[model samples]
Target: MKDPANPTSRTPEDDRLRRRIGPTIRDVARMANVSIGTVSKALNNNGSLKAETRERVIAVANALGFRPNSLAQSLHRRHSFTVGLISNDSFGRFTMPIAEGLEACLADRQIAVFMCNATDDPERERQHVEQLLGKRVDGMVITARRADRRPGLDGALRGLPVIYVFSQSDDPEAVCLLPDDEGGARMAVEHLIGLGRQRIAHITGPERFEAVRLRRDGYRQALTAAGLAEGEGYYLSGDWSEKWGYDAAARLFAHGREPPDALFCGNDQIARGAADALRERGIAVPEDVAIVGFDNWNVMTEASRPPLTSVDLNLRALGREAGRRLIAMIDGTPMRGVSRLPCTLVIRESCGAKTDTLTGTEDYA
Candidate 1:
């Protein structure tokens, strides 16, 4: 057979080697003087190869240090087959689910991912961005702790596909995916209203958080939509902790006015705390005051006296969509502007969804 490497000569076999599925496997097979099938069997333990032949192929592969040159391969296919994910959220609850969704899709495409957590530090974020860029990731997905934009993110990922999750991006042309906090909050409040709770109150996280304000707006909107007068202790803002929920409920009772018949909390932690306060005062949950919370953090909700009802942000779906969008962008399909995902109300005992009556025996069925 004529040599494949002969100058000024080209063959279909040679051209195939030069394509995105490149030369390493073929080179090893040729040097070992064996069929590619045999080489594959030896490497993957799939079938069988003669001892001497397998040893020779192993030595050849080891000597060559066979690893596909992604740059050269990508030049042929115009795809790096790699994506980057950057997260500023230290909590695994948010970022991990997103990562899992991204990974599940990418794996089907045989693409790899580079994941980095900035840990909410600016310097760390800068360093991680530089490293990911240096590694030539084809696209990037960023998930942040806040719903607001992050600086330098657009510039760092310029000329490459980028998706923002759980946050908005400063670049108006960038695609950002965020939960509809207002819609979620309104859903919680409306649920309490539907359950025959007239006096509804709300408690949430720090005032500085944009989510806090949106959720507050949602709570108020639901009340207005229902034509129900706002409760005496209409709103309270504090740290997003169980203690905050407890103190807020306590303060509501302390005002020497009407205690809420229902409460909508910003997050599950607050909801759990408020439930604790109600229980400590010999008040039965749902029977006395039905409660609904945001974020639907299962751990916190399940642990509550009567499991808390909360709003699910559909974070996993957000992540799956983010992955799909970035992949599309990488393939030259453009998507810009912020896309908000709606929240679903998850029913549990806290809001009296699984029971007989709000003011009767606590029949769970």
Candidate 2:
């Protein structure tokens, strides 16, 4: 019973369904009174057009809810617009921040990131690398939980642009981004010296680690610079754990031996353990023994008795820099050598620094 003059009158639901389908380039061209080619040029900023004409076309496209097809655009540009992120950090302690920073930098460029965790398995890592290669990613970023040097992926990479983060490759020409651990350790020791504490002991991880050696060298350099000598039992090397720190602290004070007035721990967990040990032995923090830690981990630093003052590795910034360098490398720019970014010292009650009332956080770069 449809009337000839008003056959199939549109309903609100019909209009809503039509809107969900979205507007096309042809719709935009018709509304803007321009050709489809002109609309494409305006959207991509590709061809000669007057500024006023470009603005008008763009305004029409925006009003119509027009969106370009990313897959088609990528095909036209001959790029997959994707990057691969490979990590051996199964805990995500170091990988998360770096990934966030990298994503932040690449978001504006419409690049997608594929993350793969290879754990400690060589076969798994190889499989992940092969998959990423099959996808034809524009570039790749490799990171690890530790800051040690790892074997390069020379055979697998096939000349793809790659950057290392929080770790280095054994390859001499590989680009690496890491925190300045030596400089950070020196700053911590110097701060303790400035606080009038002469006997500064270093409690660190195993001697096999390059970081441990570098930090120890920095601690020794600071002590020597201030005309202070390291006593027989001032440097202790053990496993990187709270239990190790607790045991080390007890050994330092046993047998009526002189105790260090300040303790510079390799990590926050060790510093917290040492603090607990000192508390049980009836020693007041800052008044009798001050403590400084590394890593600036919020869980350990903020939960400690006086809140630890520790070195921040600036991992996120390192990731951002890595992303920039990778982009440049993908664009045919050559990058080489290692780059060490400076760390910042977050000041809190642990280091005897007064906290800022407004922010409750202060740092020294």
Candidate 3:
């Protein structure tokens, strides 16, 4: 029973008492029926306690909605608990889900991330790497898909924990996380071949990139396995742009050698461009020329006039795996330096092939 004019009293976690009755470790310890030393050890992760007791302390803290002061924790451990991320623009599109997964993964460990886009420029990449190093990030995740040579960050990255996501270094010793691009290409080409597309043509990016080389090798391997020859005129080199794909298609048409019944594009942008060029030339897709693309970017494919069939690189899984492996590395757990995730195919209207009926025997082209 209280006076009508009086307001109800509230705990520190609610109402006006929140700041006045400050929540402290000692308070938490008392509420949790634990010793001050026990609370300190549990909060700082400095001392070991019984498993049950540790869990109980954490549960009480959470129940009280206690937020750890990161500054205090950093001061106590002398660790910034921050990770650096270096990326290119393509990686920005392909690595967003992975980045989100990484953030979620690191959040469980109470770590923060600092992301920087270098736009695939060597100078900008160098500056960003240096800036992240200057901040003394605990580790770094590099997603340089187009980085040909080691940038100026190599020397600084030495002895620092690093994980390559969506890309690889020329050096085999570097820790790398990438999807099985060759296998993915094999799946895509084989799918096309199963649709009777023996005269399949490939449109890919500059041959300088490893992904390109691997994908090309897979394509060749699939053709060879099927006893089909990928003729000299069957491949075209173009940049990873829709316009480049369109221009490449025009070049193919100009050659006047038998046009391929089906085209396997390096990526979705190229596929879209090639499709547009074919439509402009009055060639019907699937009926006249079937098409396939990689990187299942829904934003690009879903809204196309005729939805494009593409391969799913599982970028989110790629990012999640990279974050998981990096965490293991930071925890001093033994880990496989290079981890390759799997890929899937997204069936759409562009490819005239049915996934369920194909056992590498059917022919539609």
Question: CA lDDT of each candidate?
Answer: 0.82, 0.86, 0.78
Report clashes for each candidate as comma-separated counts.
Answer: 0, 0, 2
Candidate 1 structure quality by residue, lDDT tens digits, 85-160: 9888887778887788888877877888899999988889889888888777889998976777667488766688
Per-residue C-alpha lDDT of model 2 across residues 1-365, encoded as one tens digit per residue:
34578868776776787788788889999999999999989999999999999999999999888998766776788677889999999999899999998988888777889999999788999999999988878899999999899999855899999999998899989988888888888888888898799988899999888888988997898899999999779899998898888998888877778889999999888899999999899988878999999888899999999898888887888888888888898899998888887777787888776752111122322
- What digit string (tens of lDDT, one per residue) describes model 3 on residues 63-162? 8877776656666675679889888855467657778878888888878899888886888888887888777677788885543435334456766778
TM-score for each model: 0.80, 0.83, 0.75
Model 2 scores what on Cα lDDT? 0.86
Best by TM-score: 2
Q: What is the lDDT of candidate 1?
A: 0.82
Off by over 4 Å in 1: 1-27, 31-72, 355-365
Ranking by TM-score: 2, 1, 3
Cα lDDT, model 1, residue 203: 88
Top of the candidates by lDDT: 2
